[model samples]
Every structure is written in structure tokens, then in C-alpha cells.
Target: MSKKLTIGLFGYGVVGTGLYDVLHKSKTVDATIKKIVVKNKDKKRNISPEHFHYDKNEILNDDEINVVVELIDDADAAYEIVTTALKKGKAVVSANKKLIAEHFEELYELQKKYNVPFLYEAAVCGSIPIIRNLEEYYNNDFLQSIQGIVNGSTNYILTKTFQDNLSFDEALKEAQEKGYAESNPILDTGGFDARSKLQILLAHSFGIKTVPEDVFNVGIQNLGDLEIKYAKEKNLQIKLLAYAQKRNEEEVAALVIPKFVKSTDTFSTVNDVFNGVKVQTAFADKQFFYGRGAGSLPTASAVLSDISALAYDYKYEYKKIENSENLKLTEDFNLKVLFRHPSKDADKFQPYFENIEEYYGNKEQGYFVGDISFKNLKEIFSQNSEEVSFVLIEVLH
Candidate 1:
């Protein structure tokens, strides 16, 4: 906090440019971008050519730059940049969820070893300030569960499908056209994006470390008119949800999957590109966080918050990392699910269910409401040859 805060920025993408604009416009933060490293120097941009640097070393080697902001898309490259900056004893802020989730332990160790701040508030629900809230406000509270619609692309698509009565493909196309989805949106639609965000939250909320592969994740790619109709008939709304719940003092359950949300529930009302997180704690019954989950400005605002905090020498203690030893992740909890498949495939799933509440079938498709353990349901889906679709039934506490 002696000299003016100098920034070493990586990536000149949407969020990166937005951050630059915000920083330049702000009168509070005494920060200036020393250098910006981008992949392509030939790409036309509004920024001056003198401001861009093709070599990352230009930023990494500069002693004046005490803070590095990484807004890159590639997780691998982002990892390299962030690790390098942290090792160099510079404060780092990133929006890369995949990189952070995959290397949480390594990054925490780097923070301890180098004694520098590594903050990533824009990684989870964009502009929601969930991470900071979990790190500060809920630090003393015993959190029982964290559940939400974390991805905006899938949420927009689902909203379109439900309200506009559009098909899955049509909804996806609309999301793409509106810039809510990527050209190749597999990561977003397949639930991997939300899974990564959930993993990051698990560390802060429940003091647990987990990977996307360990979580039971299912995408919305298989949802069709039939499933949408079913949800409407049952007076429900379908949403892609990510959850982390404490099963016991020592055990926690986590997953990212589509669920049938009750029409009356708050989550059901969360539509379009809006995101909602419901945190259940021991003292506080339930608290909800809502915001625009994605977009350049909204996401950039979160990243800027971390940057501003860094200007004040703020760094996360990662208290959860110290208390995570006894927290074990499991998928053994029993849940009520509605499974849909071809009529001929009904018998294959029936044996896995502990109890069946209702069985309905037709020539084209069949579905059943039943109770099944998460482990068994995941196993059944994994072992099956054909694609299987299932949605978690909303349970009111």
C-alpha cells in the first residue's frame, strides 16, 4: 500500500476489457495496468497496442506489478499464469473455476508458501458475492446445505423452454444467439461448469475438497418435450441445480444435476439468466442470494471487487482448508427421483428403486417416481448402455 497499485493482467477477453474500463473509470482504487498479456497481438481491439504484451514474462518479471488478474478462458493456461504469479509473490485474482477447483490444494499451499493473496470471487455465481460471504459472514455459522441454480446459460435455456414452450434445441439456439451460451456449449450444458463451481463452494462452505468426477453430475442435453410436459403436468419447474449438503458432522453430499422444482419454491421463480443460491445454516434457517450470474459487466464487477480488496491488502485465510480433514464427501443419501426411459427399459431401473410411488408408461416413453440411493442411481446410469434421464423430486423441509 506504499506506491500506486500496479496490475499485471492476462487475457484481453470480455471480462478483462470490462475490468480495464472499470479500473480506469474508478476514482477510489489507486491501481493502474502495467501490462496486459494476450494470446494474439494481431486481434483488433480498442485498447492501445502499446498496452498489450504477447509475452507473459513481461508481466511476470516486472517488479512494479504486485497484482496479477487472470481472466483467460483456457484452464490450463490460466493455471500456469496464476501459479507463476503466486510463486513470484504477487497477489492473484482469477475467474477460472476449473483451474481453481482442480488445483485448490496446490493453490492453497502456494498461498501459504509464497505468503501472497490468491482470490477468485468471480469463479462461482457471478456478481453474487457468495465466496466472500461464505469466507466472512458465515465463517462462524454451521452451514448445513448450499443449493442453487449456478449456471446462467442453462437457466436461460430452461426458462425459454418452459415459458416460451420452445424445444430444447430451440432454447439452446436462443441462448446462443443472445450471447448467453458459447458456440460449443458442452461445458455449460453438460453441467461440468456448475460442477466446478460447486467444488469451489464445497471448500469454503463445508471445508471439503472434491473434484467434478466425484460428484454425481447430469446435464440437460437429454431433456425433451416429454420431460417438460411431465414437469408442467406435475405443476413443477425444471432447473439444473448444484447442491452441497452436510449429511452428518463428518460427512457431506454434493452433486450438480437437473431437479424438478416446485412451482411455489423460490428457485422455481428464479428464471432467465438470473441465479439463486439458498444456504441452510444451523442458526439462520435459510438465506438466499440472487443476481445476474453471467455477462461481461456483472462478472467483471465481481472480479473488480477482488481486485479492489487486493488493493487494500485483503487475502483469504482459507480457514476451511485447515478444518477440512474430517469432512468426508459421499453420495449415499437416499432421494426421491423421477426416472424416464423407453418402456422396455423400465424393468432395468425398477430393480434399483427401493419404493415406487407411481408407474406410468406409453409406447414412446415411460417414467416412474421412486426412492433410490444416490449411489445406486449413479451406478444404474453408468452401467446402462442407452442414455437415461432422471430428475430429483423437490422435497420440502
Candidate 2:
């Protein structure tokens, strides 16, 4: 029989409290929270104050606590807590995608060195369990591509904008008010959040390790009524999609960008705070995993699943990553795109595209449908022209 887990939980925010409630209510889970570390002292909490501590050593030095659950938002601080836990030979579970994506190589080495299980099912897609599925179920499958709506905050904002006729700003404000987005929502709106998750998935799906800066990602921050109206005219909905596809045997292409999904498509129907991941493999063909991508309870459920797995001595094998195949992540592919900008500045943007397939211009604004290399897309997108926007016409892998 597996040993009962004594958990030292860090961060008492949304998901933290949800985990506490769920762990207690779960009759099957053989884990108990021995200590919870939080920053604030006076903040009202759902649990008793006796269970909370302000110091990291309280949990890190506690030999009885064999599992460390890091749910903090600050990546730097999260790194410290996670590393300390691992060095102390404690199994670790975390939901911080940024920390995992940024220091994946180091964390992987740490787990191997300490010979401890480090599982993070919550970091990728709230309750979807994509990480575990990729690690175990899809270990032997020859994966062709992995793509979907990985971020829920932006999805919520986009859903409200198109479905409820709310403006982008209004929808974003509503998401923040409802706790779907953070107070400073740039991580979600700017596509950084999804990019982090994609980086983590690349290792599991294709055994490719890459940085967030190398991956070109443009989010819904520039989206407005113009794009929504354009989508409606074309019988489509705009979704922020993070995708990775095997271009050939040795090379794989990955990117996160806004795209037009046809009304008949699966992602078009995956609206609100829900996330859908479509994995294409040689054997299974295509399968879609859908669930709540963000929320206190939903995210906590994923975290709790990891805690349960730790009891049974389960950890990610990273089969694809450890395999002999030398897979490389590349951005050399060509993409069909729709670039919308002020008509007056149209000529300035003409040189960026390889060739314009179609063009429409008026006195106010215009759009260009053309093909552009992923490398050039990064160069132009860096200009950060507020008057301009870019969307994938279709994903060509």
C-alpha cells in the first residue's frame, strides 16, 4: 500500500482554498494538509488561522510533510519554494505554468537528482489533464499535432464580445470582475499565458524544449469590433489558438495566435471559460479534450489529482523527451494571414508579405489576405502597431 501524504501547501488564493475544501471532502484521498503558507496576515480566510504560517521554512523544514504543493503566482518566489521542497527530498506539485515553462530543464534535472516525483497536471489546462495524458496514454502514439484554446480568461472575454455584443474592453472588465482574469490581465490578453502552457506541452508531445521568446505568439489584445464583424461576415469565430505540428520527421512548428474557426469546427463551439485541446496522432487520428480551463474549483481539481497520484508513486516519465528521436521546434514555415490596418498605412505593410492573395481598402481601414513567413511575422508584430492586427486565415502545417 502507498503511504498517506502530508501536504505543505503554499498560497491560499483562489485554487488554494478550493483544494483545501476538496481534499477534506474527498473520501478516497489519503492526504491531509499539515501546513499552509500565505503572505498576508489580516486577510479573511475560509480556514482557521492556526493552519496558516508566514514563513517558508515552516513547511520546507517539516519532515512530516512529504509533499509540497506550490500554487503561488510569483514565478521567482515559486521557484524558490519548489526548489527548496525538492532539495529536501519532498515530492512537489505546482500549477505555475510560467515557472515550469521557464525553468523546465533545471526542474527536470532537479527531480532526477532528488529522485522525487514532480507532477503538475494543473499547469497546462485547468481540469483537462492534458499533461498526464501526453505523458502516459500518448507515450507510444506518433503525434502529428497538438493545438487548441488553452487560455480561459481570453476565451471568456472573446465569448462575451461576440455573443453578448460587449466591447472588448467591457468584456475584459467583466472577466476581471468575475475572477476569470487577473487584476493585471496582460499575461492572458497578451498571449503570454498560453505561450507558457504551449512550451510545456511541446516537451511532452514532441520532446522539443524551447523558450517562450522563441515562440511567436500574438493574442486578442489587439482584437476589436472590426475583427468580430469580419468573422461574422465570413461565418466564423475568432479564437486564440496555440498549436504545434510535426512538419516532417525531424522538424516541428509551433505558434500561438488568433485564428478564424469555422462555425462547424469543434473549437468554435468551445466558448466561455472552457478549454478544448485537439490532439492528432497517427493511430488515434484525432481526439478533443474539453473542460473548464480556469476557475478555483476546476483548477483545484487538477491539482488534487496530482496529489493523489503522488501517493501511488506516480510521476511524469516524459517518454517522448527521453526517446532517441531528435525532434526540433522551428518557425520557418509559411502562414496564410489576414492583416488589418489603416488604409493610409497599407503601403508600408505591403513589403512584409510574401504575396498578397486578396486586398480590400477604403478611406478608413482595410485588410490584406496574404502569405508570410513565421520569421517575418515576428519582425512585423514586434513593431506593435496599434493601428494594425494579424490573424491566421488557416493553420497550414
| Candidate 1 residue lDDT tens string, 13-91 | 8899889888888888888888999999789988789989999899999999999999999999998899999999999
The residue-by-residue lDDT of candidate 2 on 7-52, one tens digit each, is 9999999999899989989988899999999999999998789999
TM-score of 2: 0.97
Best by lDDT: 2
Worst 10 residues of 1 by lDDT: 388-397
> How do the predictions measure up, each by TM-score?
0.97, 0.97
| Clash counts for all predictions | 0, 0
